[model samples]
Target: MSKTITNIHTIDLVSDFKEITKMRLAVSVVFSSVAGYFLGAEIIDFVEVLLLAVGGYMMVGASNAFNQVIEKDLDALMNRTKNRPIPSGRMSVNKALLIGSTLGALGLIILYYINPITSMFGAISIFLYVSVYTPLKTKTPLSVFVGAFPGAIPFMLGWVAATGSFSIEAGTLFMIQFFWQFPHFWALGWWLYDDYKRGGFFMLPTGKRDKGTAVQIILYTIWTIAVSLIPVFGVTGRLYLTPVSGVLILILGLGMLYYAYKLYQSRDEISAKKLMFASVSYITLLQIIYVLDKYIRIWI
Candidate 1:
């Protein structure tokens, strides 16, 4: 009986860790970094990629843990976040802080081994997310704009990790992800406006779901699609995409734009949800296509 009890306790601890760190979200963020690494790497190093993935995941996990610690009370007021580890009382704030700090230090150490620039960007991402974006959520709708700084870093972070320097290629990657976040997050904000209000978060640009917010989402969607095609024009240096790949990317963008337009026309919760999913799919598939096109071009 004691052994069974111990096993159950261990499982519960693991589950709490996953919840506190938001493991799925961390993995997706790590995927973006890996894609960027592949894009910048002339000769792929599997070991370096492995290090990047582990270190990236740790940093993202640390950010999520710290975010939960800072917003424990506010999270408890929102149904969507109320059951998270810290807010739900499954984990203590001190424990979460310890996890966050340890993960952050270890992540930075690992990234430093890859390159100092990578480590610096990793630290900056954590600081901005924890210090700036987290506190700004309740103060203004521009918090999303502030949050995009760190949110856009992962893809470019990977490139810097591979190249050990910033250049137009890295800047282009950053711009693509930066603009992409506006539409993606605005759609999520639209869907969760009421829930976010429960936590005093002014997430929407207009602080309410209206034509103004929808129009901005549409505008940013167009900008994101346009920025994504910049590589095709051969101006982004090493990041140039072939015309075929560019066309494919444009098609994917159009699909997301279609959903964005639908949300504008409907202005309903269901439409917002669809746009949210479409945006997620759009970014993930875009990264995949970029990586695939890079390798295919090399082989040919």
Candidate 2:
């Protein structure tokens, strides 16, 4: 039994790496950072990209780790998060804090190497997430508003990291992502209303699953589409969308809005899941299209 327990501990430490949810967050943020860099500058620095990848991972992973720690009890009550490390007792809160602190320190150090502005942004992201967003989750639906700032950072953090400055280019990147978060989160809130209820989370307005929530979802979806199309008319310097990319982005954005509308009409968990999935693909695909447009122009 002792040996068995030791082996289980070993496995859990390995699983902690996975449980922190760093990889997925890193992938998403790195892609956006790359897209932002591609948008803002003619030249790419492989070193800055490396720092962005590593630093972004540390900051985001630390936030997720702290989130799991703060939500450990609540997570146990929710079906989706019940198996998470701290909640399931697979990893200790002490272990989580230790790991989170180490990762955060390393991330800040690496980002400082890239630029002071990037380092500051990374620190602020962690602050907003662990301090502001996590605690606010169960308090009010306004948590989404507070959370949006940190969530939207990656879209522009990359540009600032690359350019060592802020401008309309970085601001444009931030705008698209800021608008996108409302629908993404509200759709998940709808899909997980019951579980969130068990966890004491007030995820939407009126604190209920209803038509008002669905309408808000649709409104945010429309706003996201509007923000996404802004660069098409050449407003953000080198970040302009080519005709081909503009058409592609519009088609993708509308596709997401279509799913959002479907979920609003149905208000069913399955359709909410569908809308959430569509939102995921929409953001990922939009970033890809933006990056592709950047390289395409270089070639042309």
Candidate 3:
């Protein structure tokens, strides 16, 4: 009976740990990092890719844990976040802080072994997410802008990890992800606008579900579409896409834009939700296409 009880306790701890770090989200971030590594790799290093995945997840997880710790009170006020580890009372603040700090240190150490630039960006991402973005959520809509900086780093981080250089290629990748976040996050803000308001978070551009907010989403979606095609123009050194890939990317972007337009036309949650899903599908497909294009060019 005591052994069973111990096993149950261990299971609960593991569950709460996953909840604290939002592992699903962390895994998505790691995917972007790994994709970036593959894009920049001259000769793919499978072991280093594994290290990047682990380290990337750790840093993103640590940032998420710290964000939860800081937003415990705000999180409790929102149904969407009320059941998170800290807010739900499954974990204490002290425990979360310890976990976050340890994960962050370990993640940076691992990345440092890959390259200092990669580790430096990893540290910056955590600091920006925890120290800057979390607090700014309730203060101003500008938080999204501030948050975009760190959010944009993962793709470039993978490149830096593999190449150990920060150049036009990395910058192009960063900008692609950077602009993509506006529509992605704004669509989320639209869907969760009410819940976020309950937590005193002004995440939307106009601070309300209005045309102004929709307009900004449309504008950013357009910008995202534009930047994604830059590689095809050879503006990004070491990064070039074929005309065929460019056409596919444009079609994908237009699909996202179509949803963005629908959201603008209705300014309703249903439209917002569609846009949100579209954004997710857009980024995921875009990244996959990018990686495939890299190898395709080599093979052909």
Please give each candidate's TM-score: 0.99, 0.95, 0.98
Model 1: what TM-score?
0.99
RMSD of 2: 2.0
Error of 3 at 120 (Å): 0.5
In terms of lDDT, the poorest run of 10 residues in model 2 is 33-42
Clashing pairs in model 3? Answer: none
How many residue-pair clashes does candidate 1 contain?
Answer: 0
- Model 1, runs deviating above 4 Å: none
Clashes of each: 0, 0, 0
Q: For each candidate, C-alpha RMSD in Å?
A: 0.7, 2.0, 0.9
For candidate 3, what is the lDDT?
0.94
Q: Report the lDDT tens digits of candidate 1 across residue range 1-300.
A: 999999999999999988888999899899999999999999889999999999999999999999999999999999999999888888989999999999999999999999999999999999999999999999999999999999999999899989999899999999999999999999999998899999999889998999999999999999999999999999989998989989999999999999999999999989999999999998999999999999998898
Which parts of model 3 have CA positions greater than 4 angstroms off? none
Which wins on lDDT, candidate 2 or candidate 3?
3
Model 1 vs truth, CA RMSD: 0.7
Model 2 segments beyond 4 Å from truth? 1-11
Candidate 2 lDDT tens digits, 1-300:
999999998887777777875567667877887677767666888877877887888888888888888889999999988988888877888989998999899999998998899889989999999999989989999999899999999989988888899888899889999999999988888889999999999888667778898889889888988888888888887578887888898899889889988987888999989988999999999998888888877798
lDDT of 2: 0.86
